[model samples]
Target: MAPPTRACKYGLDCIRNNPAHFAKFTHPAKLVATRAAASSLSTSKKLKNQKPILTSTPNTDAPPSLSASDDNRDFDAEVVAATHPTTASIVALVSTAVAPDVLANISGVTPIRVLADGDKIAISSYTIKRTHDHYYCTCPAWSINNRPVDARTCKHLKLVFGDAYEAARLLWKDPFGNAPPAPAIANKPKRKKQEDKASEDEDEENDANTKKASSTKAKKSKKNSDSSSSASSSEDDDEGTAATKYSAKNRAKREETKLKMPALLLAQKFEPTKTDPTGWWISEKLDGVRAFWDHERQEFVSRLGNLFTAPDWFKEAMPKNISLDGELFGGRGKFSETVSVVKTNNSPHWRKIEYQIFDSPSMASQPFEDRIAKLNALYPSKAASFLSSQSSLPSSSSSTATKNSHIKIVVHEKCKNLQHVLALLKTVESKGGEGLMLREPQSHYIGKRSNTLLKVKSFYDAEAIVIGHEKGKGKNSTVTGSLKCQMASGKEFKIGTGLSDALRIKPPKIGAIVTYRFQELTNDGVPRFPSFVCERIDANKPSDAVVCILKKD
Candidate 1:
């Protein structure tokens, strides 16, 4: 079907009102009904025998040549002649309405419903309307463009239909192969205005292209473009075509190839009955940023896939072929400092940070013990035994250089039984270590959290959803007092302690899930002395209730 023009209403309404004269334009169902009604009104033979007469016939009753006095026609006669549309005139109007240029625009555009976010607690959505071949959108962009009733379209229309508005208009063709010849334009000013608008659109497009090219050049120079800069920048630009909340520079930086997340196994909460630490390899759960080294890319990435820009010199000692999964640690309780060092593009602070290798996601199919053994062989520790055992192999660097490598292999000690596990946990706790990680000796590494690994800690901790914020008082009057949180069981509590001054000024959002540590449960089952740990971005609102578990000392 051809797109309806601005004058479509007059032509279509004329055909609808006088259907017998223009039944071919009506729908098949409506046509069938009209034919049946026509047959019932009179026999078919009577209609065939009758001569076909045009609805619009020139008036012959008046004088063939009108004088000046005759040309002053009666007002009522002029009105009646203008109001009624003749059959021949209506056919001509329909032919013009479904012109090749107009029909082409109709086929390309498509309306779609979209949900647009409104206020803080509200949502607004509307449908794009296409009625009688005219398109309109309920979006603000359409309204701001003055709700054009003609062929003019807004950004929303282009986005919803497609970004082929200019092409569609230029490439329009007659669908029925019977398009009428385009009408001649005698109005020069109107034609000139259209030409000027086309010129302006072309100028705008050229300006936009120039701006984008300049921006690309500036961004390339700003970052000291590497060999990969051109390829990465172009890819970033292509991806940036989609709307994003972050800035262009930030979005480009974010798109840079970071370390693929290591699908290494994660630990579940320790359950005494279902879990037995007998013969299991145990190691202290280092409190640091979880880092994965991409041997291929020579870059470290966080669990969430953010690039950890370590100094070139720092990563130089790492093995080129083998990817390592570990913690980028600055000793115990230095997580924030380590994060700051690793997060920076280039910093001397990374020298103090160490990559403690534990597992490899690439060799995740191997059992826990075998995977650890392979990791040890690829990047041997500083121990003399490692040096003597693999001394025959050609070294990438000098033995002295290997000995001075900053990376450490976490020693996984096997526990005799549950008693030994407890004893090791106590010793580590006394030394202010974070916690213990117990791995199932025979279990193969998997990507998800499972019972094959478990975390045992001294203090009880649980995740809660942040519900609201309590304003601070006195010295802390300008900042937040505490975070009001709710447990899965619907219990609400206020966590005021252990929140840093920075966090107090801008606390976690209301629906954020955060971890909190506490000593023990109260008689009423509330966590006693609950302190803010950190936001659990990896976790959702936990299914179980947040109640403290009492561990035997």
Candidate 2:
């Protein structure tokens, strides 16, 4: 018998080693492609004994690695070139194992997929393509770095493929064996039922952690309460004549009135362009408590649906037919005081606040300009009846009563141009104002964040779902280390720095919606310098949340 050709020998060897490799050779074209691949692999083997030559230099300009440089280095291609088989060999071997259907999934010359978001609410899934030995993602992170040609990877690639990413990098010597453990910071996948035992172990760990946290919290709370009560008692004793009586009355009037979560129209963060300001209305980004006026209930509700027990007179003074969305402002730099006043049932501190109505929730169906017009009409500047008229009181008291108790329509000016907007921003910030809010002229209110409304602040803010809480250490031992949060893109991260001490002590529950502040987003859509801002009390449960501000085309 004649000796077998190189291609024939290679095919025979592949079949012998793994018969399943050729089991799907039923397709004639596939068979031909496989044979050609095998032949190429056979020819490449001749150079296997020779020293490898690396043609592509490392792309030093690539973005910084998300993890340790050593672990996430772009050495995969170099490693394959030196230690493993050639590209032809690897592709041939890997192709046989890949289901033919996967090829059909490929779009155009490169296989790209823009994954659809869960709620179809966020910016559509970004496009990602597998080309040669590298991957390209159509995300800010990838584009911002000028699209490096090297085999650099992004979080999107790791997110979609998971363990298979190792195989793509030639890091997995045996694809059939267990995949290397993914980093803890990586998106840890949900375990399969086969790992029920392991899941149970994890549950036990969580329970132990929870018990420890609870015990620590209890101890801290007891200590804090003792100190607070002691100080409160001393003050009460000193002011027993009227302060004690007033304090008791305040406590008695503190009724827990459950309110409906307000329908909030959130703002998308964006930079102003010359044309962008043309068709928008601009207003100051008030740093105050978001309050929703429930017309029918004759009450003021917090974003989380908790009732703000404004004095009976205050609620009665509000319009009866319309629901208004605005901020409760004492003034600039009064955020803490605003929060303190609204969070309680009946804080006399409310006397020092004003409800600055901006948008009418009932007018959400109307154009934004029309809504503003109607809101302004409801509280006209000349309407002295609604304005605080306690001029008979002392200068300080009279002025505060008139300014604080009265409701005022927030003024919004038509944005003339980008230069105008910039000049206005400068004027506002120069005077200690926060920033500017831009509302698309014709936009109707939506119960979610939309590009129609943009917050052009110095910093950016977005929302994510709380996935877990990391335990704190030392000074924060009884509280939390960081809030592990997940975006709609399935990206996970920890936010600790911006958290308030109170929030850290009792972090938002897992699956709660939390707002975060960041300087910008990475190429992978992960927030850079992400820190906890506040819990989105009005947000729907995590499972049904539609609160994410993904970059749009």
C-alpha lDDT of candidate 2 relative to the true structure: 0.49
List, residue by residue over 37-69, the lDDT tens digit for candidate 1.
222122213345443333445433311221234
Q: What's the TM-score of every candidate structure?
A: 0.40, 0.38
Q: What is the C-alpha lDDT of each candidate?
A: 0.50, 0.49
lDDT of the structure predicted as candidate 1: 0.50
Tell me how far the alpha carbon of residue 492 in candidate 2 is from the true structure, in angstroms, after superposition.
Answer: 24
Q: Tell me each candidate's RMSD, in Å, in order.
A: 29.4, 25.6
Best by lDDT: 1
Off by over 4 Å in 1: 1-260, 382-404, 460-482, 485-516, 519-553
Q: Give the distance in Å from residue 5's predicted Cα in candidate 1 to where it truly belongs.
A: 78
